[model samples]
Target chain A: MDSIKVFAPGTVANVACGFDVIGLALDAPGDEMIIRRSEVPGVRISAVHGADLPLEASRNVAGVAVQALLQKLEDPKAGFEIEIFKNIHPGSGIGSSAASSAGAVVGVNLLLGEPFSRKQLVRFAMEGERLASGAAHADNVAPAILGGFTLVRSYRPLDITALHTPKDLWVTVIHPQIEVKTSDAREILKQKVLMTDAIRQWGNVGALVAGLYQENYDLISRSLEDVIVEPIRSILIPAFHELKLRCKEAGALGGGISGSGPSVFMLSKGEESARKVADTMNQVYAPLGVDYKIYVSQINTEGVKVIG
Target chain B: MDSIKVFAPGTVANVACGFDVIGLALDAPGDEMIIRRSEVPGVRISAVHGADLPLEASRNVAGVAVQALLQKLEDPKAGFEIEIFKNIHPGSGIGSSAASSAGAVVGVNLLLGEPFSRKQLVRFAMEGERLASGAAHADNVAPAILGGFTLVRSYRPLDITALHTPKDLWVTVIHPQIEVKTSDAREILKQKVLMTDAIRQWGNVGALVAGLYQENYDLISRSLEDVIVEPIRSILIPAFHELKLRCKEAGALGGGISGSGPSVFMLSKGEESARKVADTMNQVYAPLGVDYKIYVSQINTEGVKVIG
Candidate 1:
């Protein structure tokens, strides 16, 4: 096919105690990218929408990823015109850039007749994240490319592991009308973490992985405590503490700042509890008079997919 | 039954990247404890053997743990005579203290007609660990009581989760004739850890949990890295780096300092691989002209149990 379109789901990274390691794909608020054959010898960002990202091929995450993937492909002379429809908002702390990057690589790979593996695709996509966020992290990219829950086991070799996720699990996300730059959010974090807090964080991370595999909701909730990152990052968001408390009161298994957030997400046992969490989170934001968007979604099982 | 005998399995806490969270029980070199109902009004340590543990109720880990359990029992007035046979060596970093404490609690609980749940028993056992290590951590105790692979999720609630363990997995442990005080081991560790190291550590921890659940041997080996505690603690053990490299070269999936040091453990894919790993590790320690003992066993499916 000369033309192809792909859908890449947004993702939630860090997943509370799993800072910089764990992430999960979402079913809504993703991005769609269309790649069409062109006579030009290089990738070009032909169109953009929903967010004011750069049109420059080198600056755009999708273009950067596609370019990286093309350089590794045996036939690097192929030309493609990319059009991006960004449904996920940038700086929402919900992996908007990852969706664009993942979608672009997936779409371009399909156009090239699938020369690279999903793991290789993820590496190329990470270059996109590096362009967007100044760090080549796979927490967002891996899940967006491979789906469900993912663990960026190590970065040196770019090892990523897909983990067990419960079918009944639901996610509730609220993107408040605020922006927290990824670089700024990251900079606010301390260079060093106390050994005490680090131990607690690792314990929760281990338990969270076990909880997912066992499909134990209570274990997941109890293990969601983020002693390391949340305490530092949540301060930037308004009513972050109350939002978490209300989300929990409304039956959220657990809630925390999504990514680096003004966006906050919660996990629940079922759709009803997820909607309840959304309602509670929205009610808090409504009183604060900030425009917000809410999504109640099951975990996205398929990550990047050919849409057309 | 007026008297009961229980055997508590030895455990490897920290499990490389897991730090103070993940642990697994072994099949051999455990502590055996005997508890008998008595007319006295309190728990007492009647006899001790195979080690230099104190016989005083408050001083001994087994006695201290049993005492803590009795305080919450309605029939606290009933006394119990405890005799401990320590087969797991002290300062071996193989949960020696935890085995004694866990075995005591399991034994006395059987003598008291099994009123408490396993979780409560672990809590009481943790108090014993505090007496031995001066820290109320439960990585070793939880696995010794819960069996298989376990995660100590939280300390405030004493939350613990039993994770899946591959049936073919094998453990190899070697304890050199050296003592690295837990206090000294802990002291040598920095109060603050670099964020880079902590991220790598937690990533490995998450992947390790995923590996156990998925039964992926390569994932297990790749995720076995420990950047937080191993570097600091391994220095206390002689030829630690060579031991690890030799163990891996001999077919160990992964290996590291068990708990604080003086002992190292490796996980292999099968019994044969475990024996190879043990042989390789022994070759390293044997040349040091130091006394050492090797154990090659499967993951203990049962924790503390009535053997007689």
Candidate 2:
């Protein structure tokens, strides 16, 4: 195929107690990209839509991600042109850049007759993440590429595990249209945490993974607690506490900040409860006169797929 | 049943990255107790053997545990006499006190016509834990009652989850005849830890739980890491670094301090590998002129069972 079109889903990272390690993919609010072979001997960003971003290949996330993938080849003579139709807003804390990065690598891999496996593409995609966030973190990119829930077990040698996801799991996310810079959100966190709180966090993380495997909703709800980062970062978002309380009252299992701030997510057992959570989120933000966007979707099983 | 004799399995608590939350039961080197209905209306410890311990009802771990269980009933007039035949050495860091505590509750519950579920016995068992260690932690008691691998997800409400155990999983434990007080171990650890280390720890805990459910041995090996407590606690155990290295080299998955220190445990995929790991442990400590004991057993599927 001379050209390939693919759709890459957005992701929710730092899932409650699984800060900086666990992430899940969403079905909606993704980015679509079309990558084509180029006559020139270098990668290029042909065009972009729905967002104003850098057109330079070296500066664009997709461009940098595809370059990382091509560099692994022996000959390294392949060239590509990429066009992005962005739907996920940048700085929304819902993995907008991950979609672009994951999609670019996936499309290029397919166009080259699939030289790399999906797991291998995560490191290439993570390069773009490094360019975007200054840290080559895999919490978002792994789920975006692998689909479902993922755990970055270790980073020194880059180990990632795909965890079981229940079919009934649904997500409701709201972006309050306020900017919470990732750097600032990260800066607010304390360098050290109490051993008591750390123990509590890992207990929840282990239980959450067990709940997913057993498909036990009550266990999942009890494990969705974050004592370390949420208390500090939640202050940056408007109506954060009220939104969480009302969403739980509306039948959400539990939730916290989606990634860093601005966007908050609640997980429910079924789509009906997820929609109710979205409605509750709307009610909380409406009175505050905050411009917010809501999206209710199931856990994305297919991370990035060929659309055309 | 008017009288009940029972066997309660020993356990390894704080299994690597699951400090303060996780534990697994062992098949051998447990405690045997005979609990029978007494004419009196108060708990009593009638006989003790194989170790030096208090005989008073309130002073003994098993007596304290049985008292806690009886206190839950409105008109708890039931009195019991317990005879202990201890096999697991106290302060070996392999849940020695837990075996007594768990055995007492299980035996008494059986004599009372099974009024409480096995899960309900954990809290009463934990009262014994509090008496032994001054902290009511359930890592050891939960596994001793629930069997297999167990997670104490939370303590305030006492949430426990039983994790899947691979069929071929085996354990090798070496208790170096040395004293490493639990209080000393707790006192040595810092009150706070770096966020980076905490994230790495939770990542391993989550992945370890996932590995258990999936029966992925390689993943289990990689995730059996203790970055927080092991570093400082290993200093207390003689040749701990060497034991871990030699165990891994001898086909063991990975291991660390069993509970606090002195005793070390390694997990292997099968009984044969577990035996090999035991031989390596012998090679390490036999030359040190340090007295020690070793046990090799399968993962206990049944927690505590009535013998008569």
Candidate 3:
């Protein structure tokens, strides 16, 4: 195949108490990228849309990820032209960059007859995130590549475990117009978390995993608490606490800062509840008069895939 | 029933990366207690064996736990005589006190015709543990009461989620002839864990939960790292590092400080591997010339139950 178009879904990272470990993919508002063999012998970002992103291969996450994937190919001379149609807004904190990077590598892998494993694809995508976020974190990228729910069990060996997610799970995400730089959102966190808070978080994280595996909605709701990261990162977002409270009151099992800030997401038991949560979140944000967008989506079972 | 005997299995709390959230029950080395109705009102410790223990119902964990159970009984005036047969030694880091507390509550609950729910029983047992350990932690006690793998999702509402334990999972526990007081074990830990170590620990915790749910032994083995608690606490135990290494090399899936220190346990895929791990651990400790006991058994599915 000369070219392939792939769509990668947006993802929610650091799900409440999971901090740097757990994340899930959203079925809507992802990035679509089209890759074709180019006459040039190197990867290139030929076009862009929706958001102003760097076109230089080395500077762009998609470009960087695709470049990493290309190096391992038996035929290293392969050239790629990429067109990015970004639907997930950049700096929205809902894994916009991850979608782009994951989509690019997944597309390039398909176009090259699929040699690398999904874990390798995740690694390549994480490196893409590294170029964008200045940190080699895989919470978002892993889910975008693997789909459903994922756990980055260990970073040293790059171990990723695909967790069991309930089929009826729905996600409601709202991205405000305000932008919170990932670096700034990360920098505000303290270098040390109180041992007490860490213990609570550990309990919640374990319970959240159990809830997902058991398909217990009440357990999931109760486990949706981020005592450490959220207390610090929520300050960067406008009306984070109010949004969370209103969302929970409106039937969201639980919600938190989607990635860093600006965008927040919640999980619900069903489509009805997810919509109700979105409506309530919109009602809360409407008075603020901040330009924002809302998405109600299922937990994406299939993460990044070939569109055509 | 006039009298009842119940056994609460010993448990491994923290489970390496899980710290204070994840734990599992072992089949052997548990505490057995007998509760008999008396004409006098209130609970009392009737007989003691195997260890020097407090007889006061309020001062002792089993006594304290049974007292909590009595408060909830329909006839608070119902009297109970308790005989404590502590097969699990204290200060061994293998949930000795938890076994005592759990066995007490389970026995009393049975004697009173099982008036409390497992969660309530866990709560009462946690209170029992509080009298033993300074903190009201439930990681060890919850599993001891509920059986199998258990996660204390939240302590505020006292939420405990019973996790899936692999049926073929075998555990090898070696208790060296030494003591690491729960208070001293906890005191040695720093109040603040480094952010990097905490992140690594969180990833492993998430993965360990996923492993339990997925029944992936390899994943569980890979996730059995304790970057935070083990580093500081292991210093108190002799040959902890070498024991862990030898156990892992002996085909053991994973192992770590059973609860705090002095006693180390490893999980294996089958009984053979478990025996192999126990032998290796014994060899490592035999050179120390200190007395030690090793128990090789399966994961206890039935936690606290009526024995006779």
lDDT of 2: 0.93
Interface RMSD of 3: 1.1
Top candidate by DockQ: 2
lDDT, candidate 1, A178-240, per-residue tens: 878887898999999999889888888888999999999999999898988898899898999
Q: Is candidate 1 or candidate 3 better by DockQ?
A: 1
**How should the candidates be ordered by TM-score, best one leading?**
2, 3, 1
Q: Which runs of model 1 end up more than 4 angstroms from their true locations? A: A38-41, B39-41
Model 2 segments more than 4 A misplaced: none
Residue-level lDDT of model 2, residues A1-308, one tens digit each, is 89999999999999999999999999988999999998786689999999999999888889899889888975457889999999999999999989999999999999989899999999999999998999888999999999999999999989999999999999999999989999999998999999999999999999999999999999999999999999999999998898999999999999999988789999999999999999899889988988989999999988998999
Residues forming the 10-long window of minimal summed lDDT in candidate 3 chain A = A68-77
Model 3, span A62-136: residue lDDT tens: 999988887777575799999999999888888988998999888888877789888789988987999988987
**RMSD, every candidate, angstroms:** 1.9, 1.2, 1.8
How much lDDT does candidate 1 score? 0.89
**Residue B98 Cα positional deviation in candidate 1, in Å, after optimal superposition:** 1.6
The runs of at least 3 residues in candidate 3 whose Cα sits more than 4 Å from the true structure, single-residue gaps closed, are: A38-40
Q: By DockQ, highest first, what's the ranking?
A: 2, 1, 3
